[model samples]
Target: MVFRRKRKYREKIIKRSIWQQLPEESQNFFIETANILRFAGQFFVELVTPPYEHKEMIRQTYEIGYRTLALVSITGFILGLVLTLQSRPIMIAFGAESMLPSMVSISVIREVGPVITALICAGKIGSSIGAELGSMRVTEQIDAMDVSGTRPINYVVATRVIATTLMVPILVFYADALALLGSYVALNLNSEMTISLFLNKVLGSLGFMDVIPATIKTVFFGFAIGLIGTYKGYYSGRGTQGVGKAANTAVVTSSLIIFIIDLLAVQVSNLLMY
Candidate 1:
């Protein structure tokens, strides 16, 4: 009986030791990942089932897309302008100044434009969605909607997600155009390139492959931003503090996701090109 008790105690200790080997952070990460996956699955399910919120979706699109134009415009213009100014001296030294339009257009279209635009949206739209939904959650407004037989997930989550997914690509395109225009302006500051000539060089440098891959990846960036923002906000803990945390986390997570997506997109684009 004594030996059996000792054996039982040893087994209990072994079990406890094994359990303790899994750190709390790791446990939380797994739990959070599972919840996010479940939330995403539910989003897809709700997205397909209808009682579609067309008005809400349209409102969200206007809010996300139109409201962000000024910020995107300024950032894109600066991006191209600075890139051109910085590259000009080097290009001149190498006697490659004439190739500036082609180089700038390819760089902006192939990588920088989509990534930078997505990051901007992630910071702006991601935080807004998180705070808005987090506030609703904290105020028990989401609960009220559920009690009233309104599916908050469908009305709120689906509309916002779809809006971001749709608007991000459009914003990227707009930003790219503005960026090229800015580059043209920069070129004219020291050179005599005509608009027609600049446009010709830019267009001539680009192919379907360059544009298509970049555009395709922006869609993923948008989806990730929206999905992450909604997830952070929807499942936020109660209280104003939680609302703040959700907004902050949403931005951080969405930005990280945008980079990851860009990395994968580059790899895929490279493979296709070869």
Candidate 2:
């Protein structure tokens, strides 16, 4: 009995040490990620069912899209202009200013435009979704919906997710166009690259691989932002403080996940191509 007790105590010590060695932040991040995925899965299941809320979905789309155009357009233009100007000096040193249009176009289309647009959308939409749902949860509005026989998850999360998935791609398309125009303006600020010449160079370098992968990535970005926001807000429990915390965590976690997803997408794409 004494030997058995000693062995049991030793095993408990090893188990406790092993648990302590696990990074708390990493564990929390995975837990949060799994929760978001579960939310997204539930959303999709509800989304395909009937009693489709067309009007609500339309309203949500308008709210996400039209309201967000100005912010995305301005940021995209500035990103392109600044990226071009910054890259020009290095290209000039190499006597390769003629390569400016191609370089800027590829960079914008492949990564900059999509990633920046998503990050901006994450700040705008992610926090809003989190706060809205968090407020509902805190105020017992979701419970009220349940009492009223409304499926709150379907009514709320499904609309937001579908709206975001549809709207982000449109925003990305507009952003890419504006960014290219800004790049042209920046190029003319130094050298006289004609509009036709600038466009030709840009279009020549952009292939199906560049465009398709980048566009596909935006859908995942939208999904991540919507799901994370909804999950954080849906589970919030601490009143107004919970609302604030949900909003902050939604933005931070969604932003980090966006980058991670992008990295994984790149690796997967590389493997498929090679």
Candidate 3:
């Protein structure tokens, strides 16, 4: 009995040591996720307070939203074309090529379009925000704002977060439209479906549930991107290298969180639909 108890204690100690020695990669991930959550909370607090920066937010919105139009549009068009082309052979094999328009559009609007747009934003806007803020932190500009009795979070974080939240949905809307157009072009490559009938079929397959949930998830994606970027940049260390690291981590983490949240959203959407 004593030997068995000793063996159990040894196992416990080994387990504790293993836990303590978690890989550096895992530790960094946890720290980054925690920081994102903390920053998001602070962002919310600032969002509700007075002294709203309407002008700055508008400037940020244009910077983020309008500037990103080209990227999103191009990506949307490619996505739709590729998706349709790839799925066509498989659809034809089943003798169901006629279902292409509705299937392609539904897939795009419901999942691919928004997620792809968000990922594009994650790589572009997310990195820019992180690098910008990280540079500011290194230069002590944020500290200067603090010293001058201005709330840096209220000004910087609030504006970017709100800007992303407002803009991503609009981007998604445009992306959905562009993607559908591309898919329609692809469909015309082999078949002769009329534009009106194709649209009717696509819209018939999609209800408010598909559009609303997908759009809602984009907001969270925006939030995650904003929070991760700001957190990494705000707490950046070292010098130029630190800013690069902050931007790198912001894009990587935000992209990962977007996918994870997307999985959860799909599961929840399935439940709701049933």
Candidate 4:
């Protein structure tokens, strides 16, 4: 009886301490952060212990990857073309026009391609997942799945996350290739450079360090986009407004996270290089 009373007292004190110490907004932020971390942890747990959703995963991959290809291709081509055109005058002015291929290749492969592609995916894929899941949540579809003993996290969230994680890297590679092709085209417009020589210069400028770190960062980018999107949607409130808010929040949050990840990746890459 005494121990029970003491425990109750301690719980009350702890609750009071939290409520008294933090502002309401800060409390909500902390609570939400904790919940997100828990959600991510749950994803990892469910990922390994699965009656795996292979079919759903494949469907998501096709949805996330193949469907996004045209957009990525156009954006990537424009990215490289614009970058080359913008840099050409500067290179010529410096009497280093011949080094343009190396400079552009390194810039695209090492940084620009991965970051820009990730931001695009965060806008497109992230918003889609958030809105879709938010709608499901608002419609009680997720609740119905729970009642039916269907693991929505595994079937819905896990599949999407895995698909993004796998596909974003592939997308980055595709974008990088397209960007180089666009650069080659831009280069030929101003001066004559054979495709063979351009390839040689681009390939020669890139090494293992340039490729591997960029590729690795895209995996994190994909994971962040998927995870944040699903989290926002899965826990969305009632009504259509909530669904819209979830989608908007997911895009904003995921974009911020992508930049954070890129910054950390750069720091780590620099450390490793040194």
Q: Candidate 1 lDDT (Cα, whole model)?
A: 0.95
lDDT (tens digit, per residue) of candidate 2 on 89-207: 99999999899899999999989999999999999999999999999999999889889988888898888888888888789888988999999999888778789888999999999
The positional error of residue 81 in candidate 1, measured at the CA in angstroms, is: 0.5
Q: What is candidate 1's lDDT per residue for 1-274, written digit by digit as tens?
A: 9999999999999988976889999878878888988988989999998899999999999999988999999999999998999999999999999999999999999999999999999999999999999999999998999999888899999999999999999999999999998999999999899999999999999999999999999999999999999999998988989999999999999999899999999999999899
Badly placed stretches (over 4 Å) of model 4 are 1-25
Error of 3 at 99 (Å): 0.4
Off by over 4 Å in 3: 1-25
Residue 264, model 2: Cα distance from true site in angstroms: 0.8
TM match of model 3 to true structure: 0.90
Model 1 residue pairs with clashes? none
In candidate 1, what residue range of length 10 has the lowest lDDT sum? Answer: 27-36
Residue pairs that clash (backbone atoms under 3 angstroms), model 3: none
User: What do the candidate models score in CA lDDT, each in turn?
Assistant: 0.95, 0.89, 0.89, 0.94
lDDT of 4 by residue, 37-131 (tens): 99999999989976899999999999999778999999999999999999999999999999999999999998999999999999999999999
lDDT of 3 by residue, 1-274 (tens): 9999999999999988986799989887777667667777888899999899999999999999877999999999989988999999999999998888889988998899989999999999889999999999999999999999899999998999888888888898899999998998888887787899889989888889888899889888888787777877888886999999989988998899899989999999999989
Query: Which one wins by lDDT: 1 or 2?
Result: 1
